[model samples]
Target: MSAYEFPALAIQDWLRVFCYDSYCADAMTSGLTNSKDTVLRWQLAVDTLYRLIASDLLHIPTLKADDLSAQKAAALDYIKSLAHHNPFSSDIEETSHWYLWDISATDRCHRLIEAYGIRDIPQGELSQGLVAALHNLFAENRVAWSDQPLIAVSADS
Candidate 1:
């Protein structure tokens, strides 16, 4: 499926899973808590990378070739548009705002953008709740990936 075809709920999962805390802090600081615009900006950042990775013709080894030039141009346009949101700008001062970069880098999920020097997202402050959520997501998902013995296993024990 194309990256644009990626489900909204899945995007939301990535947002919450990857960068919820920083977004919350920014929202609270800017007095835009629960703002739709803030959420949309975050989604745009996510979608740009998702699109690049999902592009059928844009493999990494041949990035210098002209095969996916049109697709690459479109993706770069998305990044440029995403930069207007302040948090996703390439400027060092705005690095903290690059939540998508932080999210993907922290999760070790995708680094193609960083590898290409497209953006730099410095680590941002994370709240205790966000830390806990990240831990839980990792722990639970890891258990689901294997048939290894699970400690404290019980539905309601």
Candidate 2:
């Protein structure tokens, strides 16, 4: 499939299996792929991911050259539009989480357009609960993923 046809978030998640924890920077397992020859393994892992992205074309070597510049441009342009209103920006090549980027964009869009009512239920608690549920979903849906319960304690109460 054309890279453009693929979800940017999926590509990004592959880019960063560790999700931003500095501890996971070099932890490429046996099945994990690494393309870079320089620096630490973690850096290499990140570079490998970036190379998959920002390529003018997906250089499969076996596959015939199909100039996907137009499609790539369109996808990137759309992503840039998402980034336009958020704190994140797309890089030439990113060796990190794309899922977070897209989600951040989506959440930002929701924030911009949606109005919330002040409620008796604490938003913080609700947000945390939703986050935990989403984490469970991710662990279940992903092939080999697991997570611990996230606990948040606040002094305000």
Candidate 3:
């Protein structure tokens, strides 16, 4: 499979679980809060988690509160490790490149989220479903993070 194939399929599967799971569906429509800002924050949090997974910086078998917290920290540490390897000698160039990369990563992350129908979710229930769907995805797939390039397999294989 191509690099995008596996993650795309995995994400789709995750979405299916999120949409169909009773708890998740309830959370999505529960009218828990009317605050748009709160909803946005929840969305951002979900996006961050998904970005880490997509970037292969995080791997876990579930997104229970404690496990999610621990893995998020680990992923942040991994990011810090990468930052320590600044390629440019000049501070200005490094800062510029960092922002550029951030912009690119954000764009990609948003596209992935939107393409998966995640962006269409009602604001109030976003937080309620966040952990559950991710937990289901992790439990079902037990995704493993790797920096290795994904190789394409021949159709016959």
TM-score of every model?
Answer: 0.21, 0.19, 0.25
Q: lDDT per model, in order?
A: 0.34, 0.28, 0.35
- Give every collision pair in model 2: 12-98, 25-42
Query: Clashing residue pairs in candidate 1, if any?
Result: none
Query: Model 2: per-residue lDDT, tens digit, 1-157?
Result: 2211222233333323322232222232112323232222222233332323233211111222345555444434433332222112245223242232321112322231122211233322233332333334334533112121111111122
User: Which ten contiguous residues of candidate 3 have the minimum total lDDT?
Assistant: 22-31
Off by over 4 Å in 1: 1-9, 12-66, 85-157
Please write out the lDDT profile of model 1 over residues 1-157, one tens digit for every residue: 2212323333323333333232221222222123446434354443334332333212223224355666445434434444344553366655443333221223322332233222233223333443343334435544221122223112121
- Best-to-worst TM-score order: 3, 1, 2
Candidate 3 C-alpha lDDT tens digits along 1-157: 3212223333433443333332211122112223444333233223333444545323333323366557555544433333332322256643242232121123333444555456566432343343444445444544332333222111122
User: Which candidate leads the pack in TM-score?
Assistant: 3
In order of lDDT, best first, we have 3, 1, 2
